[model samples]
Target: MNTEVIWTFLSTQGADFALKVLGALAAWVVGRWLIGIVVALIGRALEAGKRVDATLIQYLKSIISVLLTLVLVLAILDIFGVHTTSFAALFAGAGLAIGAAWSGMLGNFAAGVFLQVLRPYKVGDFISAAGVTGTVKELGLFATTIVTPDNVLTVVGNNKVIADTIQNYSAEPYRRVDCVAKVANSVDAQDAIARLRPAIAAIPNVRTTPAPDIEILQFTPEGPLLCVRPYTHTDHYWQVYFDTHKAIVATFGAAGYPVPETPVAHRMVAAG
Candidate 1:
């Protein structure tokens, strides 16, 4: 009689355990499908809004999915008679510890959010930040990736970018190309202006509305300094800058005009 009772008890316990296992499996499958549906709905809402950055939307969707999956996991654990309240409290404590330990990562994430909202610069914008200059390639939750003009790829922490000044070269419609030329005192100012002005004005991307400004700026120890200021649309700033110098060198060489030995410092800015 005792043996029969033991067998019956064992069968009941086994069946209960099997039911729990099946329930957990069902919850996992259904929960995962629901999470997918939720994520898709969120994506649709963000797409319709059109106010959020593309990269930020992707990051937010991933976070939402992770959070939902975590909740689903906890529910499944509860089916196994696990202590969920204590587990959640323990999870919160552990999260706090991790957050304190990885505070820099948290800061980067915050900065990334701020950057996305502020719209200081966007992907494909050439910018200088965090002591580096490059074209923005991607914006992530923790880091921003940029590709240098020379093709060097740099990954910078978003926190670092927030701490520095951001110079956006591509934000404006026009950029100024500042060229200084130290010509020999013997060169006639009018002649030099006449020669350089038209050459700069004739460049393909140089803006003609304001026209190119060429005049004698100041005299230094080297010789007479002529400022060759030209306005060009932002995209052609660099090319026009280098090409103008090349043309200057060629023009002076052909005219037998002397250039001073002193190096000229170039200062560029948004065109005035």
Candidate 2:
């Protein structure tokens, strides 16, 4: 090409190219500032929710920032006359592959969100879930940490817990502690019942509203099983269980009733 033709092309097209580059740069600067503002607003809104947990708020902020950035990048690419629909398809394919690979992790994340929203069991609540019974120490995004009854720390996946039963002992205000005391069938039934019921009621921490029940259960191999049931606050369940049994032994001993020398399985709860 001749020098004049080259000069003419540069003067027209080069100036337009430089203006477009400047415009894209300006858009980038404004877009980044807008993203920051939007992210801050979103964080404040989430904080205002009060129910939204801190961990979840942070995760949402990250997601919003990434989405806004992707949109901004696409806008800039459009300004430069580049194809963006192909990028969207590429991202969709990549996302599908990642989702398939991390399906378990995704399930855990969704379960965590549901847990926070539902508030089924909170920290310090005693819960039995997925065959592990313990006090819930912590609930995380993917798993839960519980201190077992034996004082061992157990981390269970969130997905596994909801998949099974969740029994919240702390949900109720009161719990019943049933203790069975079996003596010889020869013992006086009415007298034993009369002595046992009052003795159980007198124990401290036992609730008086429900009174107390001392009924003669069906005769067992050992003897007549007296079902001593007492009510107490849920927190004092274990304490009441132990103390009432002691009261039973003392009550029967003072009355000169024959007490077994060996450890008897008198504390068995009936399976429903």
Candidate 3:
């Protein structure tokens, strides 16, 4: 090739390459800035809508921003003469492989989606599932986080939670606490219940409207077993249970009522 021809070709190609690079860079920068602005606007709008949870709104906005940014990046690459079709195909293949490898996780993800949509439980609510009772700390894409009464953090798989029966204690504003007290067979069950009524009602957090009830459950060899059922505010269940128990014991003791003791039965074999 002649020197003049080579120089002319190099000059033309170099300018074109520089312009393309600049255009790609500019597109990326602009796209990133636009995504940021949109995300910020979404967050503000969600905050203004007090009906929705702010944390959930923020997470949704973040996801949208990420997806939009990815699309913009691919578009910029395509504009710079990069073949994106093969890249997209590769991405799809990888996604399929991952899905196959983690089928259980995909199921959990689906369950999580259902849970979010149905709004069965929210953060800070008390729920019982899979024999574990705790306050919900977070709801994630694949698991639900809970903090137990002992301050232990538990992570429950979304799929397992969905598949199992769930008991939401915080769903209602009030709850009833049921307690069983065993009195001596000699003690009058009805009198024992009457004595407990005043004290149970006086306990803090115990509801007055429903009125507590005491029933003689069964007659054991030791004494009469009684059941005490009291209605209380949901938040005061534990407090009422413990307080009522102590009050019942003290009241029975002060009344001079004899508490039945468990008697041991001894079988005597006659000498043969």
Instruction: Judging by TM-score, tell me the better candidate of 2 and 3.
Output: 2
- Writing each residue's lDDT as its tens digit, candidate 2 over 43-96 gives 998788776678888987898999999999999999889999999999999999
lDDT digits (tens) for residues 1-272 of candidate 1: 99998788778787888899999999999999999999999988987877668778888899999999999999999998998999899989999999999999999999998887677888888899999898999987789999988999999999999999999998988878898776876778778778887778888889987887788899865568888888887778789999888877877787789766543442222232
Rank order (by lDDT, best first): 2, 1, 3
In terms of lDDT, the poorest run of 10 residues in model 3 is 263-272
Model 3 deviation from native, Cα RMSD in Å: 4.9
Looking at model 2, the pairs that clash are: none
Q: Which candidate leads the pack in TM-score?
A: 2
TM-score, per-candidate, Cα-based: 0.71, 0.81, 0.70
Q: Rank by TM-score, descending?
A: 2, 1, 3
TM-score of 2: 0.81
Off by over 4 Å in 2: 1-10, 14-19, 22-45, 259-272
